[model samples]
Each structure stands twice: as C-alpha cells, then as structure tokens.
Target: MSSTLQDLVNRAVFYSTEVQTHFGALIADAEWEVDFSSDPHLTFTPADGAVLRTRPHLLGSESDREKTWLWGWENVNDFPDAIVGLSHEVRKFGAAEEVSELTTPELSLDEELALRLTLAAKEATHKWAHYPAAAGAGTTVWLLVDAAEIALPAPQVKVSVRALMQGLTQTTVTDHRAAIESYVAKRGIPTAELPEGGLRMLFADGSADLSFDDQRRISNCDLNAPLEGEAAEQFAAAAESTGTPAEAATASRTSGSASAPAAEETAAPAVPTPSAPAPTPTDEPSRTEPQPVEEPAAEAIPVAEPKPDEPAAEAADASHEQKQPENEQPRADESVQPAEAATPAEEEPAEEAKPKKKGLFSKLFGR
Candidate 1:
C-alpha cells in the first residue's frame, strides 16, 4: 500500500494529539488524572472509569506496508465490543464505531489505502503525536483522534467484506445481534440493505458509508442526520465524543479527506461533454411562468388610412385640412383638384356610423 505521510513511528502505540485533547476534554468536567508515559503504551488513566489507549499497527500486506491511522480504549471492563471489520473482534474499542475492509479483488492496494486515509482523517483515530490541552468542559465530552500530529498508520491486509457481512447476516443470529447491539447497547444506529445488494451502517451524525455490490465491491461511498429524549441525550453524552480543530483537521486529512484520483469513465471524451443542467422542481415551475418580452408599444406604428368613400374618412380628411397650417399646403406633384373644384359639387352623402357601447370599466367609473 502506498501512503502519503509526513513521518514514521516505531511499533509503540499511542493516542493521537487530537484524541488526547478530546480525551482530556472528556474529563474536564470532573476530577481527572492523565498518564503520558508509556506503561503498556501511552494511556489515559481516568480515575473514575474507562482508560483510553492509542495503538498503532502496520496494516498493509507483507509485501507493501503503508501508514495507517488508528486509536483505541485502554481499560474498560464492558464496551459492547465487536469488530465489525473483516476479522478483527473490535475496532471501535472506545465506543460507537465501525470498520470497513475492501478486498484486493474489489479494490486495489492504492484504492483501499486511499479510502482508509480518507476515512481516518474525519472518523478514524490516529496515535498520539500532538500535545494535549483539555478542551472539553461542562456536561458534554469532546474527544479527538489526532492532536500531536501523529503520522498515518500502515495499511493492513484487509479481510473480506463479505466475511464481515456474512458474520453480520441475520442467520448468524447471535453474531448479527451482537454486531449491532454491541454499539446499540450504547445507542440506536442505522443499517440498511443497499439497492445494489450490500450492507451499510449509519449514524444520525453526518458520516460517510460505503455502497458495495453483491460481490462485495464498493460501488460508491456517499458522505451524508436527528436526536431525541432525556435518556437518549444522557446516553449520547456517555457513548463517545470528539471535536478539536487541529485533530479534526488532521483526522480529516488522513482518513475521510484523503485525496485520490477518481475512476475515469472507460470512454471518457478528450473534451468535456456538455451536460444539460437539470431543472429543479423550483426551476421547472419558474420556467413555465410567463415572462413578458419587452417591445415598443403599438402606438409607434403609423395608423392605416381608412377607406376613401366612408363618411368618417371624408370627415377625417376635412378635419385634417382644418388642422394643417395654412402655410403648409399638400405636397405639389401639381395638386389634384377636389370634385367640387373640378365640377361644381355632385357628391353622394354617406350614412353616419352608430356610437360605440361603453365598456364595463367606463360605465362603472363613468369615464
């Protein structure tokens, strides 16, 4: 496995800077004591209850070892424990967790490493590499997976996802129930059968999950939560907590935010394909709404001359003649004479037109 890392550490396991900071915060509300020296490795010997430990391991194949990010609890007598990972008995040793393994057949070494690194940064816990400053206080406990800027962990020989799935199936009654209850005994989470045929674990928090096919190949991973009750709130408060800006950023970089190239389309175009933007429901309605086009009003067009024989036309002509300035005569192409001027008047009188009816508005407003 190829890892993009900035440092290399020995076999000694430890909590990351962020995790220590968070663990520190987890105890800020009460009387607490911290142990920094490596007794059985770096530890958090909280006086009241659980002891947290940071453990690191080279997780990749014997042929190629890459850095990985990992952390776990130290001495907790009971932690609804189960390793939902390919084979490990427990990954969320602290509490509220999950582990994903991609088969070499399903994902390449690089791809798996890429995915692991991505997840670790945001969700996974790394060994101690930073100093601790207890940032958590009040009733809430905030924990981080990295604080000392620990180097990433080595990628391991990941076990089969199907094996984990098989162990989690309902038929394996005890294991299946344990798989979920182990965490749910803490809090209720989500699990669903994918449309493409796979399994997923979900939480109310904005987390990521993998979607695989029947063959247990990851098809896609989506990065995508509610809460209730006093008892529920108390339970959540006790389950597990983490939030440290530095460690959050480190965890983000190592796991959930690891950068890797996406799979290119088999027949990708050299030039980008022009995609028509899909109209949203809101956009569609707005598109159908009438939008008036701006244009000059009809008054700008010259009015057509009326028929010559109509009495209204004759009357209009007479009115025009009256309205014209005496100085401005008709254009001379040698002006044509009127019937009266030519032969001393012999014109038929035309019928008068009826008046138009008043409109509704005109009648109502007396306009």
Candidate 2:
C-alpha cells in the first residue's frame, strides 16, 4: 500500500529451493516484451482472481486481439503450477542435478527475491554479500524487527529479499523495488528508461527483475551460520583450544611484574639500635661509672713542720704563772700550751669533742 513489494508479501511463505533456482534463471534468460502504444491496467481481486487487460500479443480471436486484455484473479490458482513447471524446464538449462530437481511450493518467491535483492544491493554498493549457492542449502533469512517501525505482515504477502533488507535497514517493511520505481517515476533516473509499457528498467541485455506485486531490493550479505547459531560456538571452541601453557606462564609473569614494586612501597621502615653503631673512644665515658670528688682532698695534704722548744725564760715564766717558782722550768712547757699535746691520753677528749661538734653542725646545716 505504501508503494513497496514488502507491502504485498506475506511472511507465511518460505522460498523453496525450486523457487530460488527458477527465479535466478528467469532473470538470466527470460525475454519480456512491452508495448507503450496504450497503457494497460491489470488487477487481482479476491472474487475474480487475477485479471489482465491488454492486447500485447496476437490472439486466436479477432476480438481478443483487438481489445484490451482482461484476466481474472482465478488465474493465480494456476500460478503455482505454472511457476513450478517453469522452474523444472529452466533447471535443465543450469544442468546442476540439485538445481534441476528443485520444487516450488517448498520455496517462497517473496523470500527468495528479498535474499537476491539484498545480495545484489551489496554487490552494487561495493560490499560483499554471501548467500547459500543453493536454495535448500540450509540457509534462512532471519529478521530482527524494530516494533515501532515495521508491523508484521498478514498471511497474504510473501517475504522478499528487498523486503528483508529494507526491513533490516529502515526498520520497516515494504516493497523496496516499488518504492524506488515510484520515486524514480516522479523524477526519472538519467541513464535508465521505462520499458515500452511496463513499470521496470529496460536494458539492452535484459530488463531489471521487477515484479508488479512482489518487488524486492538488496541490503547485505552474511554467512548462514549466524542464523544457525553454529558460527559463534565454533569460534568460542577454537579460542579455548588455542590457549597453551606458554601463554598461561606469560600471563602470570605479566601480572606478577605489575604488582611487585607496589608491594615493596607499602612495607614499614626498620629502626636502628644503639649497640648496632660502631664504638668510638668519645663514647667510652658515657658507658663508665663516675668517680667520687672527696678522695682527692685527703691526698693533697702537706707534712706539718715541728716547732723548736720554747726559751728557758719563757718556759720558766709559763711554769711560775701556774703557782710554780719563776726560776723553775715550766712543767714541760705545759703552762704555755695545752697539756693534751704533750700527753697522748689527755688528747682523746679534744678529738672526741671536735667530732661531736662536726656531727651537730652536719645535722643542723645538712652539709
């Protein structure tokens, strides 16, 4: 309805091997002739089936040849059979055992066209597109839909290559070929010309493969395994298998080298002990016990000189003063000096008194 083949294709139809092979041949070898003298209108209705109105070729009847052709929708019922027969006949041309035996019902025309368009677009765009060489070569078109852009198709329309690519890229579904044709119709492509009467590109060798209801365009090419889910698993297995012991050791060394310096930086500093240093002569006094200062005072005393005996007169007078006659010698000069010095036994009281006084002074003055 939006002017794209995707608008007409139904997702329910899957392209069988027979359909893909046949369609490829149709594009390669089919000869289509168009008349531009008068425009013809063709319509397909549920009630009438497929109808064609045109006199493009001569008919057996004069009236049939003279008037515009009209065919009913009922003719489409024979379409499957016609398409299958056409494929079988074309298969003989390819001569591949697999291609020649392909069936139609098993293939979806819309889906196959979509796949081709996708691959072609890649080629045209200078990108590589890959598809299974065979229709039944275990390949499937997987679509990742964006719900906001494209709605699911009804049971009527078949999926096509152009539809699949457009759906994937624009996140929408429509007949890509129809959209482009409609676009170009308003402003023609400089190098392309419309067919004599048909809505398709005309070329010397052949016409572009454009269908009226089931049109298509190409988007990309990818391996089949992604859709099958086998490629990823195989890659993972290969990666795991290739990791050897050498790699493990190298990884371990790398990890160790990274952390070694950081670990050393976090360790605490060591403390130095006093004895751990070398012993020097200046340090000897600090280790020795101190000497007392009082011992040196006693060793410094000088010898006392003895005095000569006093004169006889002085001695006689000192003796007479203590009631002895002046002419008598003083009793061993005792009158002039204390008698304790001449008598050792008398010296004991003086020595004892001196010590008692010193003891009393020491206690009071705390000397």
Candidate 3:
C-alpha cells in the first residue's frame, strides 16, 4: 500500500518543479522499512539510504550530465493509526483584463503556489480523502495543524519572447523551451529551471493533491473549489483597483442610450440628401435628349443611300452607251473614258456600304 501510494503520487507529480524539489529533499532523506510479526524487529535505515540517482542525460564518453534523484521514506508497520488527520483551506485570487491584454507579472510564484495549494486542499477534503481505502482502514480524520508556503519565481526573468510568440502563432506544441523563452521575454519575467527530464507538476493543499505532466499545463484544475471563487473576486477587485471606468460601449449600443454619437454621424448625411434630390432630375432630362439624337445618327449613317448607287451607276452607264457608236466606244473608251463613268467605279463601295447595317459584321470588317 505504501508503495502503491508512492507510485501514484510519483506518477502524478513526477514532472512538477516544486514537487521535484520536495521529492529531491525526500529522496535525499528517505528510509523504507517492513516489520513482520514473525521477527518483530525495527530496523534503522539511513536517511539518504533509499534514494535513486543517475545521470539524466546521455552524452559522449567525456561528457558530464546532470543527476536526478528519487527519494521516499516508507514504513509499513508504523502507520499513524491512533488518529487519522485531514484538513482543507482555499486561498483564491482573480484578475481580469481586456481580451487583447497580455499576461502580466502580477502573480508571484508564491501566489501561484498558494492557489495550487488552496485548490489541492479543497479537493483533498471534498473529493478524495473520503474515498474508500484499498487498505480497508476506516476512520474519520481532522486537521490538527496545517501550513502552506509559497515561493514565487522572481521578476525580470529573461526569456525568448519571439520564439514563444512564433510558437503560439504557429500552434507548435513541441518546442516548449522556445515558447518558455518567448514567454519570459514577453512577460519580462525571470527564467526559471524548466522541466528537463520526465518531471511533471503537482499541487496539494492541507487536504488534497493534484498533478500534471511535464508540459507545465494544468490538469484537474478545480474552478468550482471555493478557493477559485475567492480568486475570481480578487480578480474583480484588481480590475476595480485600476479605477478605470467599466466599458459600457456594448451596453450603450444594446440599449440605444448612447446613440447620440452615431446619430450625429447619420444626421450630417441627412441634410445633404434633400438638397441632392432637386438637381438629380434636372440633370437627367438633358442627358436623355442628347443620347436619343446621337443613337439615331449613328444608326442611320450606314443604312441610308450608299448601297443604291450600285444599281444607279449601272443604269446611267447603260444610257451613256446607248448614245455612243460601237466602234467609238471600243476606240475612244480605251483612250478617254468619261470621267463621270470612271468616278462611279471608285464610288461603288459607298453604294455597297448602304447594305452594311443589314450585316452588323459588314461595317466592322469594312465590307
């Protein structure tokens, strides 16, 4: 049962930085023992006896890597059975900003830790502590004493702000180191040790506990915990502390109470419209008269009298030939044809042009 509990916690909080520190201290001072009825013996194990340590990074032969430690102290026989104890407390604070606002350095590591502990405590008391035990031990416990301490990471932390922004924009979840660096830059906060190995997160209050993986993302956040309500109130108070007027723009629009400004914009355009109506109709009549005359002129030019000249020229030439001798026509026509008759050959195209309107394409192709 002890091993099982330890394993469960280890799985839960293995990646947490604070939890890592706590576990490190624990591993460095841990002791494990088993007392059987057969032997009835209590063995003294060294405080640092049960710790496991190893090089967490792989490097070449000459390279040195950081060491990781897992520590625990366990005793199967010395369970605190006379009276079990449980307690809970929630400390909550909340803040709000515009959706466009950036994360601020308002929260100290200690404050965040307090929030976590508060959440953890509430969970311990209301959710987990009363759970049926695997060991079959049954008893009610009360908190005789409890304390929660918070240590916040310092300000002015250097981080890769650009990397964080880019990663966020690109939705790249894998490069958290870059994102963390970017987060530091953007928030102007100090860079703390990141989760380098398989470490995850853990939270515990006087009563309960919660944990998450190494992503530094929260798991099992209990917003319904009373602590969270206080947090929300704190956030509201923080916003009020700024003394900035609450934004009423949306409400103003909804209720039409503040429509005077919009009305001013709309009212200016109204004055011009009545004046505009008078000139619009007057200008329209002049435009229509010019357009009708121009349309007919353009249409009549091609279809009028040009094509009838082809037949008229043939008739005039036949009359001219009737007045000339056949021999003179053969001889004098070859040398001195009448200019009027010669001119009609050049003018025949003008005659053919009269039929052009019947073929829309004839005018375009110069037929």
Candidate 4:
C-alpha cells in the first residue's frame, strides 16, 4: 500500500499538473494532501477551485447527518470545515502545520499540487477528478483512494487544445504521451528523444524543441519561437529601432559623404582642365592674324630707304627712264615732289639735246 501510494502520489501530482495546464491554475489558491497513517485520509482546504466547483462530487457525498454548510457540503460542529478535516492532519504534514501555525504563507509547487489533488478527492472509496471538456461538458476521470492505495482509471480524456500540449511536458500521463507521440509520428514529425534531456520534433526542412512549462503553461520553442506575423513583426520592427532610425535625408547624406572623397578625386582633374586651357583658344587665333602682318615686307622696305638719296636720282637719265614705269601708275599727290616729277617735263630737254648731238655727228662724218 505504501509503494502503491507513492506511485499514486506521483500520478496525482501529474494529474493535477495536467488539470492546471488546461484550466489555468485552478489550484492557485487551493491546498490539498494525501496522508497515509493509522486512518489514511485525503485532506485539503479552500475547495472553491473551478475544477472543484465545476465537479461537485469532488467534495465527497454528504453523510446522512447533513448539517448546514457554506455551499452544500458537509460542515463540522463549530466551522463549515472548508479545511476538510485537515486540522488533525497538520502535525503529520509539515506544510499543513505551517498553514495552521501561519509559519509561512507560501507553498511549494509539489505541496500545493498534492494538497489540491487530495482535496479534489471526495469519498474514501472513490475520488474523481476531471480532464478538460472533450465534446460537451468534459471527460471525468475517477481516482479510487482508500486506506490502502490510490487507483487511476484508463479512460479517454477528450482531447482538447490542452491535450495537444500534454505530451510536450514532463508530467503528462503515459496514455497521453502515447497518443500525442503516435499522432505526431504519423504526421512525419520525426521525433527523437535526447539522452541528456528534452524531445526534438523534426519537420521536413526544420525542427523545433517540444518542451512545455507545466508551471507557466508555455512552450520553450528555443530559436523557433514566435518570430513572425503580427506580434513578432511588431517586435522585429522595434528591433530595428535599437540603432536609431535615420531619416531619408540623413541616409542620403551618409552615402553622399562616404562617396564624396572619391568624387572629389575624380572631379579634381576635370575642374582645373577647363580653366588651364582657357587662354589657349584666344592665344592661338590672336597669333595667326599677326603672322600675316609680318609677311608683308612693304612697310619695312620704307625703313631701309634714306630720305637724303632721293635728290640724286633726278640727275641720272636712267632715273628718268625708271620714272616711266613709275608714271604708269600715279604716285600719291603728297608724295609727288619736284625732284620726283621731272620725268613728265623732260620732253623739252630731249628735243634740244637731239639737235646738238646731230650737228656734232655731221661735222665728224663730213656730210
């Protein structure tokens, strides 16, 4: 009976944990116990959990000596016995003593779960606890607790959303683990159990850690935790804010500043190129016009002539002959000096000298 009770205690803890997971901490304020002494009793307190109130039979069937109680349950002479015969069991269970003595208000997880599950037990012959509703109300699971041992029934727990999370935890029942694993295996989840700890669920492309917190009722998805969609997307958007969001102008300025030096390196050569050759175009055409002016030596020819030598040319008869070509073109009116104009009036001298030369020739020829 002791070994059996130990196993039942383990099963009871596991059972209460599953209930807590489904109903959301129904035993948060409740305390329960499973005491095995001369008169074994399942004692507990504050039996107003959603599971207890929802399942009335958990308080046990009322004896024939029905005395008025708080909410339709058996009560003692002085008090309603909401503590449910736990006052005497206080010394046996130190936690009950602490609660009775008010030594400490806080309850450990194991103690709290045990007390709640035990309080959930009703009749010494048969005590029943419920699983989350399957189809209609819910699936009711009965635990037969007596002075000897506790017994759990092999009943189907109408699988709820909580059932999906059942096998992922450390305290799920054997049947639930089988059902969850079988279903997961059929879907090709490719599960592999770890030696150190934990269960690994594999997908076709990726995998995730299948671990749930019985206390917090959450999964430890590890790296694959919610990192997408709405809430995760909001988180992702806020993640970018860590570096401080830059404005459009600021971003552009950063890029422009980074490229500024290279642009300056390229543009440095080009800017001076235009200015360096600026005078070349103007200088080349200016030099070409003066090149033709140097070729005309007529202006320089006047510099080589002496102004005093022009009067000697009047005595030379060849100069008079040379004047014939000059008279073919008219000289400038201001340039026509008397010394330079004697050729046109030389007709009188030519006729007078011709007759004197003929008389001298006749005397020589005896004509």
lDDT of 4 by residue, 128-173 (tens): 2321100001111111222111111111112112223322222222
Candidate 3 lDDT score relative to the true structure: 0.18
lDDT of 1: 0.22
Q: What lDDT would each prediction earn against the true structure? A: 0.22, 0.19, 0.18, 0.23
Candidate 3 regions exceeding 4 Å error are 1-16, 33-86, 90-119, 122-367
* Alpha carbon lDDT at 16, candidate 2: 17
Question: Relative to the unseen true structure, what is the Cα RMSD of model 4?
Answer: 60.9
Window of ten residues with lowest summed lDDT in model 3: 267-276
Better candidate number, 1 or 4, judged by TM-score: 4
| TM per prediction | 0.18, 0.14, 0.16, 0.20
Give per-residue CA lDDT, model 1, range 110-222, as digits (tens). Answer: 31232122223222332222211111110000112222323322111011111122112101112222333232222223344445553444333322234543333334444
| Model 2 Cα lDDT, one tens digit per residue, 24-116 | 111121111112122311111122232222111100000111221111111121222321222223223223323211211122223134333
Please identify model 2 stretches exceeding 4 Å from their true place: 1-43, 46-83, 96-367
**Highest lDDT model number:** 4
For candidate 3, write residues 1-367 as lDDT tens digits.
Answer: 1112122122222112211121112222222211212222112133434332211100000000111100001111122221111210111111121211011211222211221222223222221110000010111011111111111121110111111111122111333433233333322222112233311111110001112235543222111222234333433343355553223211122111122222110100000000001112232110000000011110111111122321110000000011123332211111111111000112355547633111101100001
User: For this target, which candidate reaches the highest TM-score against the unseen true structure?
Assistant: 4
